[model samples]
Target: MQNAKPLPSYLVHRYHGWKATTWTENRAWYRRLADEGQRPRAMVISCCDSRVHVTSIFGADQGEFFIHRNIANLVPPYNPDGEYHGTSAAVEYAVTTLKVAHVIIVGHSLCGGVKGCHDMCTGHAPALEEKSSFVGRWMDILRPGYERVKDLPETERLRALEKEAVLVSLENLMTFPFVRSAVEGGEMTLHGLWNDIGEGGLEQYDPTTHKFVPI
Candidate 1:
């Protein structure tokens, strides 16, 4: 038998076929969107992990949220001198330009990046002192996680650290002037979330509760 190529139906998205019907369903809404412009309601900052997909979890439509993904979902402290600042740039645009009402930092359990940080902390692996490792440097933002959860056992400790990293990123998001101003002005709210892809449960942070509860 000849080696057959994948079907066009498999390669081509079904959404492309639904264009006419989709537009018809929301014709008036789309007309207003064209006239006004896209104004997304929320902005999501999530990890670049292939296992954790933000769009599917949020059940978001295309124009509902602006998304930014980086290693471990870290939001670094704002600095003009830093050579790489793509994440910060995205946050600024979402908050200042798009004027999103919510900024969500979603982390996940069993993250490879977080596990790498855990390994470095336990001295199980050699310290990545060299600048040559791009991913190692990116994982640096979650370094503090190991120390903070060092007292607990490996399993529980790592889970706590993973959640802690989300909180840390939420704090880092506030360091940006645009984020801070929007938050202070009641224009935006910061949310820290953890998704357990392995188990299929969502936990959202609650300020008053000071803990994550199933949502």
Candidate 2:
């Protein structure tokens, strides 16, 4: 507790500004949302990258989206070993409780996590190869994705691996029984998206064509 501290001065100032403007203007809506709880239509699984603003990209208001951000925007294969599974828990809650109609996995260009996986798989990042590195272990979820794109030209491999992360997550998500049931029952849909941050371009995976087309 001794190390705990109040919000930083800059963040505090920003919060005050937002509270005076946005919060005050939407007080009634905020109150109603607090009273009724959230009923977001979609669950967005995206990377923890600070630049990837999911809500801003979609023009979503508060309570309109259930977003879960993690390294490389990954979803591991379902394993109920009584361990802590933040992403999986979020998925279960959104699917079973919130009953979101769609689950969207968003991957992005220049993802550090994806790069780490690439480096680790290629034996370029020795520190990440250590057993004690949390990020290294986490990025292991995308190892298979790296393998799929490792042979491509160095220039195109990163982008390809980035998209592959989305595909891997989409595939891993279906390994969950509840997700599979929901999709099979026509109660839910799954989507994979890749964002080109610099170009402000978005591409969506097309299952039929087996490609990502710009959107």
Candidate 3:
């Protein structure tokens, strides 16, 4: 707590503005949500990128989606070794506790985390290759994905790797026993999505064709 700092002036101003406007206008809705608790129908796993706004993209309300954001939006394979697994814990709660009907993995174009993974895989990012780098260890989950698209041209490789992040997460999600059971029992469904930040384009993975199509 000694290292904690007060909110910046800009953020303080913005908070007051939002509280006076948005919160004031939705006081009843906010109170209802606080009393009833959240029962979001979907869980959205997205990147820690500032550009990727999950709620805004879906025009969702505050309690509509149970969202978890992490580097590269990657989900590691099920490893219940009693260690701290933030993403896994979020997924577990969403599926088992919240009983969300759908789980969505969203990747985005020009993702820094995905690019870091690509660079590390290609030996271009020595810093990320270090054993002490938490990011490097986390990104190891996407190594298989990088291998799949390493042969492509430079222009396409990054984009492909970005989409691969979503694919890899989706595949890893199934590794969780509860997720597999829920999906197989038709209690839940999984989805993969990619967003083009500059172009404002969104694409959904088509399992039937193994390709991404504009949605």
Candidate 4:
């Protein structure tokens, strides 16, 4: 079992085709960017789910997005303690050091993290207190959003709450001095996106319309 037989037929075929030609030839560019400090133009907060690779979903090339993903793509209000704060630190660095032009908070359909938050608010979530898991801690950021939208229907409400969570993170983005300063100076913009995974469609939040507009 240790000695694998042969490459899978699909991968073997792909290796002789697009994957081989494109990514293989482009490896040098990626290496060069890494060798130099990457100055990405955008910062994306996305889901930690394996299925939602932000770069792949956005069709972004290497070094294009300074991306951070937590459960449900949450961004806690700026809090700088001595302990590990991976997501918040990434945001601070991106907005301050990297000076990204835009920050996008991305949410998606049928997100497990969103479901977890919903369940937690309704007292139906798994007994998570016993374990010190990142998911448990990270989902806390969506608590306010869940509570605010709890009166809506289950299927529709969860989805709405998920979008509300993205907006909440966008609000959190403003809590950072660097981000707020940049936006006030008209140097940066914040956006919230909701992706319908079932239909492979995207909607951008419009504050004026108070709705998600297909994009």
Which ranges in model 4 have alpha carbons more than 4 Å from their true place? Answer: 1-20, 129-133
TM-score preference between candidates 1 and 3, better one = 3
| TM-scores vs. true structure, each candidate | 0.83, 0.98, 0.98, 0.85
The C-alpha lDDT values of all candidates are 0.84, 0.96, 0.96, 0.86
Whole-model lDDT, model 1? 0.84
lDDT of model 2 at position 132: 100
Q: Count the backbone clashes (under 3 Å) in each candidate.
A: 0, 0, 0, 0
Error of 1 at 107 (Å): 0.9
Distance from true location, Cα of 112 in model 2, Å: 0.4
Model 1 residue runs over 4 Å out of place are 1-36
In candidate 1, how many clashes are counted?
0
Which segments of candidate 3 are over 4 A away from where they belong? none
For candidate 2, report its TM-score.
0.98
Please provide, for model 2 over 148-209, each residue's C-alpha lDDT reduced to its tens digit, 9 standing for 90 to 100. 89899999999999999999999999999999999999999999999999999999999999
Candidate 4 per-residue lDDT, tens place, 74-162, comes to 88988877888888899988988999999999999889988887877787866643367567677888888977898887768988988
Clashing pairs in 2: none
Error of 1 at 181 (Å): 1.6
